[model samples]
Target: MTTPTRPPKTRRRPEWLVPAGLIALSLVPIVAGSARLTQLTTGAAVTAENARFFDSPVPVVTHIVGSSVFLVLGALQFAPSLRRRRWHRIAGRIVAPAGLLSALPALWMTVFYDIPTAVSGPGLAAVRLVLGTTMAAAILVAFIAIRRGDVRTHSAWMTRAYAIGLAAGTQVFVFLPYTLLAGTPSPVVYTLLMTAGWAVNLVIAEVAIRRRARGPRRRTGTTVTAAGARLS
Candidate 1:
């Protein structure tokens, strides 16, 4: 007679509080400034000034396609139905490719993108390239894992990757608090906020991987065991 072997125990990972904090952070711009939308736009590296690509109509195509990819993929993150149905299989088919396409334009656009996100100077280009490239790479790997039916690996990587993908909007808060309290210059605060955004999103991704690796637990049903012991 042999005892059943249990599944391997997984290491724990930290969960991000930012999603819940998103509401509070989102309010700062609205409460402090009359031009919430405009402020958000200023935070982006992309602007009307250097929006050219491939000599003719690259910006237009990138904007339209990238915007669509980001909008759809970001929305899919919090969607309970998709998560419940384990729809990553279906969504991955579309999302993985879209993310890849978006990354190219994001990296290319960085050439003309001179804005510093926090920490300052020429390093901004490196920061943008690294964040964009890592996100694209993660999705590609996760997509491959899913095609092979590696559910745990797939979910972990994809969720973490998506966290970075969604960081642009969430990053606004990292420095918004200090900006509000100190009343510092917009350029100074905006940069801090953006840098913090990417870092936090990466943390968010690690959290997702940890949570998913743990998976759902089976409900314990009360029962009587042998040897006069109670087991549930």
Candidate 2:
């Protein structure tokens, strides 16, 4: 009897694509923050109008460092290679706490930090406060979910937290065009743009989660069809 011919191996989609895109999207704010940090370290002249920011800088530093660690390392969690290699869990040990610190500092800044009245709006502050608080809660709940052996719930909650945390990255896209056109948006306009950023990112996150939820069913269907063919 002739040996059975095996089917050609199907090419697996690159699981790194999504995480790579996410990392690229998040780099805008990270690079900009790094540039500013460099300037500060090099003894750049401080403007009188914004002396407070430079003077009491711990919150900004905390926010930047925490955000960098969380977003960059967190994005890697989505890579299949990292997951298979078990590095995702290793990274999560750092990412989870970093996410909490990233969001809580933002909430703290929203509450205690003063913004220039001309550009500051209550609506934006409220948006920041709510998103930041929820992000922190998501991280906490995810941690608890994983400990309880509910991996699905943990994944969902962590995704939500990460979606919220990407607000800064999304904001770059929103503000750049507005700034180019308007030269400087009013407080109301600024609030709307920032809100749009968070809204868009969350929407994308939800869509991605839905698609992921459907993937297993699709694979199962394929497996069943192949088995039936073999029996026939």
Candidate 3:
């Protein structure tokens, strides 16, 4: 029998869980990831100096360009006024080229990506390679869309592309709590998280934007019906 004086149990999730999940899902590498992922998480390309910080052949140009372009792209998403006010266009013009240059270096570096250990089948490696390539191609198409004045297509492609770019940040944020509680190795956990997260984020952005797009159309139809009723 429950006492009437008892307060209802709160079912609040911890605030830290969000960041922890992001880190767990994004930042870490596989049980044995390509050295590239290791390079990636350490902020390898955040600055030109990172070239010196990394191995020769220096993923420097790629890192610098990718980091900077993504920063701009990610910022534009949060500023609706800026997005609608032509500022996003001007910024997009600048970021699109920069993003392409960044990918040139990234795609070139793919050969060094290591396959997962203990999984002798080529499938795991193949999946990573394909997804990574697909992400690069999507960004390139997004850049082209902006240049062609296809704003709707640009917005959709860019959101998916930028979500992939932002995956690094989100991955770092996802890797903590789940990994801690689940007790997975740092590398395997990170790799799975980042790859899985890319797909998840892409789907989520598409669904959310589609919903927002549909909402305005629905409201417009409703308003037209109301106006017609008043006329009648």
Candidate 4:
């Protein structure tokens, strides 16, 4: 009698893991944005940290609400099961516009908000302008790519845009150590931290895109090898 055959080892598919992690990372900024929105709507105590928001409520509100929608719903787009369904297309329509609304107003705030130099120096403002422009441009390119039926390009661009938009979430982690070790950061230090967050996200996005691009080739190679083995 032969020994019992071993059960086939199946690899776990982390379909939900990326989306869940993204949503979790986004919670800090989402909660903070909600609090700011409440303060704006409810006539709460206006402190120096938020007086600018009160003075220029429209852009801030648009940015907060739009970003919340973009990040939360957009994160769901990463779910492979959802992408296989029609929900992905429907959500894409909403996510693209939401991304634009989130990004454009950020540029507006960066240019016209009149934030004090002590709070956000020229360096930080410049970086914000660059990142906002990049995010908006990436979304636009992604939309155009999908329209042209270039799905690979569309996905790559969308990933870049999402990564840039998610920088706010990552900024919380980036600033925590600095805040704890140094008590408070100077405007220069703040700018550096912000840059680091954006840089980290963009780098990660690039790596992911590259790896995804290779996946199909790898599968094709494996398929060909299996076929050749059968033939031999």
Top TM-score hit: 4
Cα RMSD to the true fold for all candidates: 8.9, 4.1, 10.9, 4.1
Candidate with the greatest lDDT versus the true structure: 4
Q: List the residue pairs that clash in candidate 4.
A: none
Q: Which sections of candidate 3 miss by over 4 Å?
A: 1-53, 113-128, 186-190, 215-232
Off by over 4 Å in 2: 1-12, 219-221, 224-232
Q: Per-residue lDDT for 132-173 in model 1, tens only?
A: 888788878887897898877777776666666566557565
For model 2, residues 193-212, the per-residue Cα lDDT tens digits are 88999999899888877766
Task: In model 3, state the lDDT of residue 124.
Answer: 40
RMSD of 3: 10.9
Alpha carbon lDDT of each predicted model: 0.58, 0.81, 0.55, 0.88
Q: What tens digits encode model 4's per-residue C-alpha lDDT throughout 1-232? A: 9665443444766889999999999897799999999898899997777788999899999999899999999899999889879999999999999999999999999888878666674488889898899999999999999999998899999999999999999988999999999977887788898899999999999999998776533232133231223111
Candidate 1 lDDT (Cα, 0 to 1): 0.58
Model 1 ranges with Cα > 4 A deviation: 1-64, 77-80, 84-88, 112-122, 184-191, 217-232
lDDT of 3 by residue, 1-232 (tens): 9543433344755545543443344333321133554666665664443343345345544555554555455455445556666777777777666555555555555556332343223344554556556666876787778779876777787667666655555554565567777865455555566566566777877896696455432232133231223111
- Candidate 1 all-Cα RMSD: 8.9
Q: In candidate 2, residue 13 scores what lDDT?
A: 75
Q: Estimate each model's TM-score.
A: 0.62, 0.85, 0.61, 0.89
